[model samples]
Target: MAEEEKRASPEPPLPSPPESSSQPEHPPPETSTPPATFDPSRMIGIIKRKALIKDLAAAYHVECLALCRELLELQKRKDEPFLDTKATEDLRKETLRSSSKRAKKKR
Candidate 1:
C-alpha cells in the first residue's frame, strides 16, 4: 500500500480599490431621526374626540330622518291630526322615496 501526502492550497488575495477619482465623495445616509415616543394622554383625547364626533354624527342622522318624516307629514296636511292613518302613510311613502332617491344618487 502507498501513502499519499496532501498539500494545502494558498488562499486567494483580496481585491484592490480603483484609483482615486476627481469627483467629490458623497457622505453615507444619515439616520439620526429620533423615534417617536407615545403620548397616552394625547392618544386618549384624540380617541375620545373621534368617538364623540362619530356619536354626534349618528345622532344627527337619526334626528334628520325624524325631522324629514315630520316635515313631510306637516307639509302634506298642515291642520290634519297626527293620529290620522293617511298622514302616516304619506310620511312613510315620502321617506321611502327620498331614501331610494338618495341611494340612487350615491350610486
Candidate 2:
C-alpha cells in the first residue's frame, strides 16, 4: 500500500533559467564613453569660494602672529628691539597658492 501511494504522488517540476537582458553583460570601454562637459558659471563659483577661503586663512594667520609677537615682546628684555624670527615678516608676505600647485600637491 505504501509503495503504491509513493508511486501515485508526482514530483514537483524544476525552475526555468532567468531570461537575458538587452544590455551587454560587461560595461562599455572608457574610451567609448561620452565627451566631458564644462560649465563656466559653476567653475566661477568654485574659484570664488577658493579665494574667500584664502583671504580668511590669511586674516587668521595675521591675527595669530600678532598675538605671538605681543607675547614675545612682553617676555623679552626691554633692550631687544623685536622678535628675530624669520616668520615674523610672513605676515607682510603671505603665501599665494595657484590652482595648478594645489592640484599637484593633492596627487
RMSD of each: 16.5, 25.5
User: What's the lDDT for candidate 1?
Assistant: 0.82
lDDT of each: 0.82, 0.77
Winning model by lDDT: 1
The residue ranges of model 2 lying beyond 4 angstroms of the native Cα positions read: 1-36, 77-107
Error at 25, model 2, angstroms: 6.4
Residue-pair clashes per candidate, as listed? Answer: 0, 0
Model 1: pairs clashing at backbone N, Cα or C within 3 Å: none
| Cα TM-score per model | 0.35, 0.38
**lDDT for 7 (candidate 1):** 36
Task: State the weakest 10-residue window (summed lDDT) of model 2.
Answer: 92-101
